[model samples]
Target: MLGARGGWQALRGCASLPRAQPAVRLRVREALGAREPAGEVKVQGWVRSVRSQKEVLFLHINDGSSLENLQVVADPSLENRDLTFGSAVEVQGKLVKSPHKMQNMELKAETIRVVGPCDTWSFPLKMKERHPLEYVRQFPHLRCRNNMLGSLLRIRSEATAAIHSFFQDNGYVHIHTPIITSNDCEGAGELFQIEVSWVEKLPETHFFNVPAFLTVSGQLHLEVMAGAFTHVFTFGPTFRAENSQSRRHLAEFYMVEAELSFTESLQDVMQVMEDLFKTATNTVLSKCPRDVELFHKYIAPAQKDRLEQVLKNKFVTISYNEAVEILKQASQTFTFKPEWGCDLQTEHEKYLVKHCGEVPVFVINYPYDLKPFYMRDNEDGPQHTVAAVDLLVPGIGELCGGSLREERLPFLKSRLQRLGLADAYEWYLDLRKFGSVPHGGFGMGFERYLQYILGVDNIKDVIPFPRFPHSCIL
Candidate 1:
């Protein structure tokens, strides 16, 4: 439709258009360990330290991509007078080899511009001093600027990705379970109820027509999905109204739960949990070696060998009766005496793991009365045990808990009636009535896993924002 002269003009105009410029900025992690020298580059990060001499000024910058900060050597004439600690700045320079023993490459700055000015006297973090984690925890909003917390956050992110990859690669469908649920999975009765209000209210009215609470576990919901999908998992926030201020408990935390259908054997559930732990730990160790090293050297020195032992050895498996015998014959004094039907305490779990060479061990087939109503009955006469499994590690006891579900309708109804919870779970009984397969699932506390891996003493230090009994700051 166009003439030759017009077509030629349009082509010339298109040729004259400007192309998009390529990005020139490199992260501090890349800038510090660049294999080849880059002629000209741009870097942006927060200044960790500023050392000024008469001729040259040395600026250490970090962007949280790595544990190490990149050193920038700038001339005195580059207008770096305001480059104090914690100041955000953009640096334009050439990447070159550094003579310093700490790092490999340094940025030779031609121009330095301040993006945000920081007052050194008012900043909470000191330049060259290491602050205690407890002290830095007070400033929840700014603690990410510190090296330890920053490294921890990076490792957490990597671990999350590794977990997702593991599940996805193994044909597991990620199910986003409901956060607000009507049923309590644990049956511990420690639930936080949801309250709602309206400007124009009726005499007796509530949101859901009944009562609701934040979910304590996603295992029940994952089981619902597992009836349709072969393998399903959920990783999300779970809440509990626990009043204790123990370092091991959190009012709000994350849980990783998985359910598998057509699984009658308890070994299937234990095998999946073991593989997940080993795979995720291996991935974190390979990807975050430096961050793990930081935690090993500073946070927990003894945890390194323990974690290695867990990865190398096959997890030991034992029955609950065997564990009870061991505890009864042990020399260690316990607060609670070993009984046949009692639940294993943290001390007992730790002793069991230690008895098995300080590696992870699975204690299976617990007493039927100790578990919830959903667990399948093993029907062992006089002993009366359920097909339940709990994985205990050395540093942290009871890392994971799971059980084979009761697929028979009559048995489930009878068990629920005995527990006085039959009326509250009619829909659950329907799952058994209308074509239910043999299913099982497990729940792993995400914060506890982080604490186990990072060797952090308190669970609060591992999470970004901790919610416990009396504290919910920021």
Candidate 2:
């Protein structure tokens, strides 16, 4: 029987057979990392590559958990067909440095243990065949095994954790907001309506007395919490049925929202956004170095250096009027010319940000007609009531959307009445009626932010399970 150390010794001594070696142990990753021949290593992982050389079988194995894979040279006399591609196995081998970089390390196996067998017909992942995103999305279970999807998912996880940590360290209370809400916070009228079926003797309503729609944002709810907590935030999945197939929009996506009470000005909101973006990007860069490297190398080659540029450069802030002016000046490419009152289209947003280089730029003070009714009116400005700021990135525009809310009950009520939303927001007005403060918050599109940070094109690539305008793939 091979001891664990002896098993590793067998793998290391594979290039030249170790004399009279007992049992050995090796993991697929450790065999891949085997640079020294003095010590023994044991590794276990899925089969990544296989080649038959007469009597010996040279196999490359990877454990989906990491980017590294181990090289195993097994004698065909052991009848190791059970360790085929996608199969899990344990190998005891001696670690030896490889002459070539492709197979940087080598393992000579004494005993190979089969852990589990992958279905030949069902296992779609293989070294020879790499599937596209559309086909991979069809197989959700195996999608993570692919290099691009795996790195993107890993970055998503890291970014999520970083977002939470950034909020926690910055004296913000993490609020878990409700998913079902009666209010349409954005007031865009693109809601996915919720209804229930009742076949037996019906009530007059089709919704089974539950007049609820999926929450488009947690901003209002976080405001309630911010009243008590001073600084509060919510990270949750929000639903939007806008039917927009844009590269930045998703029907169901995560949002990072933070509402701060007693902010001095819009500058405070910009500060929070800049700090949060930096923290998220730096955290992912540090924690998921390998993933970041892969993204920098393959998916987004330009973004690797751009990440640092965004971090080091000071973020620029401009008014909606100024952005419109710049857009109009650069209107050669835009189909819809930028007007004073018109909303900044995604194309215009991207063009302006590209002008600002890789740094994030805040487009503030949008026109009253272009924004929601909740934003505070600029007292010193002309007719622009929207006290909003949208954080624009280089490749992806509008990563974060936020505003200083109208805190005064009278102004809010008057705006609601003018917009014909008083009836819809009766409860929202109540917050202002009871006890209101100078509260402001912003909503960051989680996938949009991820796409910007990761340099990905389609928003679908950033989300693990994406729900688009017409897609609800399992």
Compute the lDDT of residue 169 as modeled in candidate 1.
93
C-alpha lDDT (0 to 100) for residue 352 of candidate 2:
89
- Summing lDDT over every window of 10 consecutive residues in candidate 2, give the lowest-scoring window: 21-30
Candidate 1 regions with alpha-carbon error over 4 angstroms: 1-23, 79-81, 197-203
Tell me each candidate's TM-score: 0.93, 0.85
Q: Write model 2 residue lDDT over 1-474, tens digit each, in one string.
A: 899999998888798764664545544544555556735556777777678878887877766555656677778765465767778777776777776767777777766787997776667776767566667777766787777787777688879999999999999998899998887889887788776655574555645365688999999899888778899999999999877888778899999999999885888998999999898889988988887787677678888887887788889988887888788788367877878888888788889888777578999988777878888878756664578899988878788898898888888899889988898788888888776788788989888887777777788877888888777877
At residue 5, candidate 1 shows an lDDT of: 96
lDDT of all the models against the reference?
Answer: 0.90, 0.80
